[model samples]
Target chain A: MMDKEKIKFTDEELVARFQQGDERAYIELVKRYKDRLLNFVYRYLNSFEQSEDVVQDTLMKLYTSAHMYREIAKFSTWIFTIAANLAKSELRRLKRRRVVSIHTMGYDDSEYEIPSEDFDPEKETTSNYGEKQIQEAIDTLPDQFKTVIILREVQQLSYEEISQILGISIGTVKSRINRGRLRLQKLLKDLKVR
Target chain B: MDCYSFDKVISDYIESNLSAKQKQEANEHLAQCPACSEKLADMSQLLGALRTLPRPVTRPDFESRLMARIERQKQQKESPFIHVFHEYSRVISVAAAVLLFVATSLFVYTSVVLPGSPASVPSASIRSVEPAAALPAAAAGVRPEQAGGVAEKTLPDTNRVQNPDYNSRIMMVNE
Candidate 1:
């Protein structure tokens, strides 16, 4: 999905160029993964505005920490690690604010719009509700389970790649996704209640 | 696969990501049991639906906003915020050290050790420039008066230096 006119650079090329202070490569990188990274964070926190803010912070981190990247891992994997850390930190800050008993700083998950026409795009008419139930069940799962499940099922990353991003063992990633899926099945079990 | 084993295999089966032996076992089980096959169908469909879910379109200002924010941050980092503070403190410290060294050296030179100057320049006045400037003149003028006083007071004392007897070996050499 990369543009052919531009030099066919690997993620590593873009990273190396970025480290050498080439804004073009960084721009290319931002163009490449901005939406994907934003979606991951958005789905994780379930807030578009907050995810946008995180994506900005993530790119800033990439720009600043470019030299800290290693050659062994994929550039996307390295970047997602930073995004995940920021997501973790932001989540912590929001939770602390919530505990003060003030009005919530971030909106609750109900405000999250799944980026799909799978739901009826037309507000005038409603279609099958089964899919909506599945989405809701997924939303109900805890953050850890949800992260693993989304990375595996939605992002379609390999277990090894997910492990590197999350900085957990592959075993843990598998267990978490397994647990997350089972939890979803449980939550959606009575949908067509046998 | 047994029902208990079926749970574990369900994920691998839905992903179509099982080992060969696991795949054979799952196929055997799915051929017999409708329940797991139904679950597998549902799970695979769910996964397929999720994978098909589109990534949200980034807002129009996304790149510019990110660039602006990152530029601000890079400027902050490049501004030498902490580095400037540290260097300023170092400059202040070195200046203080040099001042202290000069002050201490001046104190040792003007006080404590010079024998005749302790009389000519009062300790407190030596701290000021006037007494310091007067010291050489005072010593030069006093030398003559002392010479006359010595001639009148003790002619014999002149023999001590003029006498060949004291330091006679060196005095004879001078003579």
Candidate 2:
């Protein structure tokens, strides 16, 4: 009965409880956000394992820094900001690692294995291929457009929420979402042609 | 509206964010323009696909792992050393302050007070030393006899020699 009651509490209410040292409230908050954060982070990183790590780190930060949260900002916006910042850091770290690996490779070193994208008759269908194509198109977008597109289109967050998470104006969020969609349309069209 | 202008307002039009007049203009333009209409269709299709994309779930043990990490973090926060420090912090601070006060008082006594104590130097020696010390006063314009008498009358009886040999050495070194 208590668990069911906690499940009904809003994210902000849960955070407020957690601030007052309610351990169960923290657990409930984690349950509510973990998968959502994983999905958001995975879209940004395109790597499930790293996304999970980023989400864990984000929750850990929330655990340690719960006192820093102010009631003025929406709880979702604050949590998503932490997830997005960590995802961006992870992306940068991956890029740096790739650069280092490239620099260190020698002619005698074995060739890096590229994952095959061969069609699987049993496992993959038309919808799967379309989804893959759309994801690839999204991946090709610039960071700003990709983030806005994922937040607006994929996550289905309000413009106000995206603006708060990204620390931008609502006008900027709308413009970015529009431009991101336009760019995504072009990328998908290009993909279909290929 | 031409294709370029229609492109500019397409998103606003789709989102119903345009004013009625602008929206009406966009509608009339869309009716005649195949290219602009196709662009809108493509954008709609892309947004639909994005919305329906499969959301990935975390691994099965995600909760357990997070709880374990949180437990470890709690343990670290409540570690014995930190716990002890927090418990005794006020007492430690007060002790430190008292020690500092005592050390400062001792330093002041040894450096400023002890050297001036009468037992460190007899009062008779101070009176005898004052006459020799008055040579500098004499040089500064007072007559030697007047400087000696002034030094004798003005020098405090409680004055002690800082360096035991400071006055006698000066007297012997000069004489």
Candidate 3:
């Protein structure tokens, strides 16, 4: 039984240990990634609960598919790729379940309107209000731009790292980050104004 | 650098991707150009906000929840088929029993009951009669008795009366 506090294995080493049936290594691996993965997924999903679930799901995959984790790729890259793919598919599932109420009750409504119909004023006065606005701005971005921006700006991943994760060229990552940032700037200009 | 060229390199400039010489040129252009400088400032502020955005912390039980979930997942993956079977075990067993019952019943009917029935072959023999049953009252009684006896016995000797001359004599006598 390894000391939970004293185990200092790297992700790859821990994964190797996990494959060797070290349950402690698995716990340590989950501890190492839970927060970072949660933050990364929360930014992409814009829902903390869903992000938590997705992180759990991602870790579960990492646990079960430990044998599939060859050492050729960095464990962070492989794990982050799993996280990204799960987040993307979750977004697709959410999108499919999202009903387009553009012509509700035979009345034309703006499709791009932020769904503040259920907004609670009490919740708006809470802490980190600007952060919520910024998140909403990020949420308005296109999926391609949204993904690269979150991976870059939020996760602070290098362009080359993001390129590998997204399977795109570094040039594409750079251009997307630039475009995403510019779009975000436009959307959040009002935040600066206030 | 003119504004057009500055626009293209501004992102690289903010990200520190520009060469030193190009950086110096951009700095010189920014010194002379307030518009481009303000654009750069906006981009910087945006990047700062994004980088400094407050992240939500996972709850204290995040690991426990994940581990519990992982354990559940491992148990499921260990027996994916068993999980499905367990979920629908009653329905599946009932369906299997019903299918087995139907199959066994069919097997018994075909192999034992059907082949042993005396009426099975004789029913085919009764259908063999074609024209001679039209001989009026006399032949009608004979036809029915033959048809009835054919159900319990092998076919009667129809080869005797099936002769054309015999049929003609029987038809003349009847008329």
Which candidate gets the maximum DockQ versus the true structure? Answer: 3
lDDT of 2 by residue, B66-142 (tens): 89988876775779787677779999999999999999988767765676554445655654555555668776887
Candidate no. 3 TM-score: 0.67
Global CA lDDT of candidate 2, please?
Answer: 0.79
- Over 4 Å off, model 2: A103-129, B80-175
lDDT scores in order = 0.70, 0.79, 0.75
| Ranking of predictions according to lDDT | 2, 3, 1
On DockQ, who's better, 1 or 3?
3
TM-score of each: 0.64, 0.68, 0.67
True contacts kept of each: 0.36, 0.47, 0.47
**lDDT, model 1, position B24:** 93
* Backbone clash tally (model 3): 0
- The sequence of per-residue lDDT tens digits that candidate 2 reaches over residues A83-161 is 9999999989988987888889887975343221341212322232377777788789999999998888879899999
Worst 10 residues of 1 chain B by lDDT: B147-156
* Interface RMSD for candidates 1 onward, in order: 5.0, 5.7, 6.9
| TM-scores of chain B alone in all candidate structures, in the order given | 0.40, 0.44, 0.45
Best to worst by DockQ, what's the order? 3, 2, 1
